[model samples]
Target: MVLVGWGEQVFRAGLKGRGCGVDEGLRELAAPFVVPDPSGVAIRTRLKQLTAVDEEVLRRVGAHLGTLASGDLKARCHDGLAHDAEAWATRKRELTPLSSARWAGAITRATHEQWALARRCALAHLQSLQAGVHALRHRLSLPLGQKGSKRAPGGYRSRREWHAKARRLRVLEDRLARERAAWQAGRVHVVRGGKRLARMRHQLPAAQLTELQWRARWEAARWFLRADGESGKRYGNETIRIGPDGEVSIRLPAPLAGLANAPHGRYVLTGRVRFAHRGTEWADRVAVNRAIAYRIHHDPVRGRWYVTASWQTPASPAVPLAAALGHGVIGVDTNADHLATWRLDVHGNPTGNPRRFPYDLSGTTGHRDAQLRHALTRLLHWARTCGVRAIAVEDLDFTAEKTREKHGGRKQFRRLVSGLPTGRLRARLTSMADAMGLTVVAVDPAYTSKWGAQHWQKPLTSKNRRITRHDAASIAIGRRAQGHPLRRRTTPPRAHRSDVHGHRIVQAGGDAPGREGPRRRLPGPRTRSVPPDAERTRATRTPTTVRGVRGEQEWVPDSLLLTD
Candidate 1:
């Protein structure tokens, strides 16, 4: 979603207004000519002075008419009408009205206007048709590397766009020549002005002086034109400036000289939209990490101006950190759940996160990791103060990669990426480390996690394997862990698996493999048995009564501990 910003000034529609009203003027200029007058005064006129069409031809000479867009054609047509209308009127004044020449005069003048409009439009259409064919031929010349149907791979075109133009061009050219010759050769002049009409030339006002200026502006915007699909010519923001003052002063492009609104699909009748009280302006500059303006459009329903721009963000750069104890190599494993880090010392043996590993910020060690940048910033600052030397991080190639938002259910990957404090962490860490002359290394992250954090009392086997949770971390102490550690009993931490799960198994004995002995037992239950049947019988039999040396109380029961 793009936000509406400034530069709403580009949507004004009054520049074309400065130019003549092509159709309206043409109709007015034609009105007098098309009616008969009682007085006759042989009016003389020059061929070039009569119409917008003369200008149309001159413009079309430079215009790739066949390639001329509809907007361009409409513009040209507007110019033609305006000019032809005025010229037609001026020359018609040269002829005195006849008492009986009303209908004839109107028909003759109307015929002249139609003929001119048809010729210009048809010529543009024909040229476009031929150009289109040539272009298609070039495309078809390429090897059809693969084969299929009309819409197949590597095809020329699915449909031709300039067919009708060719027919119209041929038809109009034929008709114009025939009529011109008929009039020039003194075929007929039913009304008083009819003879002078043949000398008048017609041009549409849409493509006249003012309109040509707009076109020139469009041509100047090379790249912008390519990107925005040639959105017609702009008049240097004058339309907007003019509307506010209710007055306009502008240099006229020859094409706009006698311009007027065309009746059906007329030049001004089309892409020219008129709005009430809208502000428009040209953009001066665009900033970074901010939205870039796209375009301004006028909404008829809202009656309000809106602008749209989108923000393009940069990638998450890396940060390097190092400390004493020869810890330089850093391993980072990022996943959907958490980021695991291993800090390897001088000998390349990696240690796990410390109680104060500087990554943890809030909840568990994992929470600290989530706020990686924030935590890194603090830790890096602390490290700098403590005089750490070098910092290292894993380096994996990004190489033109893009993350695909999973099309399935809610993507766990996207959530994890969003929640990570990636960008800030990298920036702050890199800055702090570099300032302190701490070497920042982005090394391979491949198998750094294979070795457990520091040395494990037990092997990396299933029975002894530990997995860190989203809320826990394993903290590695020194070589001998110093003192007996006072047997500070507490909950054990979780494990890391992303790039750490190695293939080490633990043995049942206390010692790892070669140094182990048989399993030790604790006081529990008798699990041994004597000779089977005989022992069983002895245990089950009752003892016989025996005479013991008579002491006055010689009543000892024959149950001396129940010997088996």
Candidate 2:
């Protein structure tokens, strides 16, 4: 626990101070304050534990600081170049996690499997800021034309060009507005200062260094006890002893050896676990199995202790797309609140009744998880009933798309984006569907909603039923997966008579036949023998002429004249 205490103190101090990274903080401040290690914990392990805590704080703070910078720059850009440049210069030194300390601390202490997570977050945010700067600069560089009360003769583009420039300016204006909003709201913070940690404590059970280390131990409990290339002796091995009454004892690693001698040794470092159906197989392979890894964990919610064992399993055979499509497919439309699904035959025709399974995500983590589980269960059950071996869904990603919404997008749209359960739903569906012997097919999401609404909506809707845009989208998604054309076939319209003599026209409408306009009759076949002989003698042919209105007239030739 000494490492935890020291780490927490150092982290708090680092946040208060201006300089020093994780390594510098450790060497300059925390390394000097080492306490007694009576438990035989190595210096290396202690340092690692401390580093993990500090790294977490840095990662979270860095991410927010980058966002803070971007927001400031955007706001400044809106006012003027001078203001934008000034703010950009100042943000490098001024941004910090101090503004929202409780939220910052809570986020920094969130559970992460790796220390590199913080660096990744910081880098990602920085890159995003750079991209925004480039885009904004490019937009600002365009020839937007002069703005004035009166138009100048040659100073502006045509109406079309002017409208396009106006559109670009409006887009830039909206982006800046979003940035300002993001800054005002402190984009990354979960909640405000007072009573925040108290509220999040349950969600974050292992925020402290000691608790974190314990959690790590449980996670890493499964380790392969093997030999070196030459010595054939295992490192980090535990001496396991079994009693006559099926009791078990274990001598743990150096850091945990003191726990082995503690009063709660059995509960802390060792405990008995039943093997169940694989008991005999495990017993037989105790000394024979090349790989021997075991893990033990406690489910805080269930109040139960369980042991886990791992073994390599063979890979499942790959199912070809063509083969899977032979059995028909289930088209799924993932939405913010529910999954919309429909079954389609091999020919892309809807075969069964559509289903909608709703789920609530605006709840506790456990509650959301339970809701998702129930939804997936029902969807899969229905899929099984339909006897479709393959399911088609949109390959979607919203992170980058939604990132700017928190600052620049509409409030309703932003809320909808935030509440979308796309990622988690996709992951859960894939694994569960696999376990139930079904194939998951991902298709392009482009124009599915538009095409679906345009073609499928009215057809799917009826006197007794109303089809939603998403339901139509689901059908579109399935059809796209099966490589079918989005447009439906229609019978050709009948031909219509035209104003031109002896000619017909193909009309698009189903209107009744009627005189569109006055028609002109063609002249009878011409007699040319005498006229040709006279024209040959003249050595030239006269051109045709037409009469004018108001009794005006023009000359005409026999072979090239109009008849009255």
Candidate 3:
């Protein structure tokens, strides 16, 4: 997600709704491409069709899709199928298997798409192919759209986009090779990077298909990617699966959001699976439409597939989220120290508000990040148990890397959060929620903690703000160090709260002794959210007791209070 300035008025509005026309179109496209008695042709034969039977021109395109990247190859095929339902009926075409002309049209369509992409936007060209495949499955598998065709969208610029994409692609390639080498040895290096990027690496070992598809869809989305790092998002009840074998596929229909003019809210789902059948076991042809998506034939070396196509024509209405949205919302306050939280009921009242959970590690603070993480996880687990579906958190400033506090410890923390990486909490939360079928909503936590009740806010003045409060507000008149004998007066934030005989008392400062010299006033109260580059909130040592009043206690650890 791109981060605009805070004052830019970020509205969490959904994209314009559109009926799944593309999906329907794809499903319809696939309906005629399916072949019953498939004659699997060799990959070489498929390559020969595009090039002459001789070895010269065919070598230019390369034997596989991977080889086609460098050279300026034209995918000269049909932009789309050229068949009308009425015309087909008039021609008395059978509804069963794909005909020779139909197969030719498929190749034509592939060629046309490739050509279209080359001239305008390379990314869009790629995105369309993948989205076409995705939309096809959605429409075919489930009834997803009413008879409709929204304005077919175009792709974006592919030049600068490809450079950035290529960099990442190369990085992915290097990582994959290292992983493969490590994997073959039975044990792998403890990858100290992202689990999702890692898992994504494993799911798509070779970057060819995924890489091509990513660029393609980015082009399709008009160069806009879904916020929250999703190129395309799936909302309602959709479950994507990868077979045990290295077959890449997803069943659309339910939960696949942001589709061909598909409206917001929820959808029952609709779409069909499409893939190229490349093996000579089946005659070379583009196939589409059927329950499961066709993986077609794959190459062992390039890890590419051909003879596959995506089906469309799925349709469903958007529905309300019965469990995911309506139940309750869990608001997580991701902190630099710990994960503070407050659970709100349906009416937006704080029902189960818990003080900040202890997420600070003894030696290293970054490792304690897992505590906040685990706390969020526990909250999710609780939400799951409590039947609360959606979790809400503030949108974090994560697009750019920000400096962070160094968490110590040789092993406890390790690379858990070595150099701060302030964006970990929300990132992890969203990802975990995705796997658990939970919906996560991001809100603006602009002034939640800064603006509190009078009882919570009355302690920062020079005088004891709590005049009616008990003796806990006392300052032990102690002397400054050295021969300079002097009476010192100051109030200090102490550790260990006490409520003896209805009188509140606490130790001044924390675990260690007072300063070596006289003490200057400590920092002021820190704001809820830390400043991006600089520390925003000031720290203060004034003690606050809310036993009879708000009863909300500020739990600054004894550590920060300790004068080192």
TM, every model: 0.23, 0.48, 0.26
Query: Which segments of model 1 are wrong by more than 4 Å?
Result: 1-343, 351-373, 381-388, 396-410, 418-424, 447-564
Task: List per-candidate RMSD values in Å.
Answer: 28.8, 25.1, 29.0
- lDDT tens per residue, model 2, 520-562: 3333346334532344543343334443223346666887765
**lDDT (Cα, tens digit) per residue for candidate 3, span 46-98:** 21122122222112112222222112112122112333445334332321122
**60: Cα error in model 1, Å:** 45
Better candidate number, 1 or 2, judged by lDDT: 2
Maximum-lDDT candidate: 2
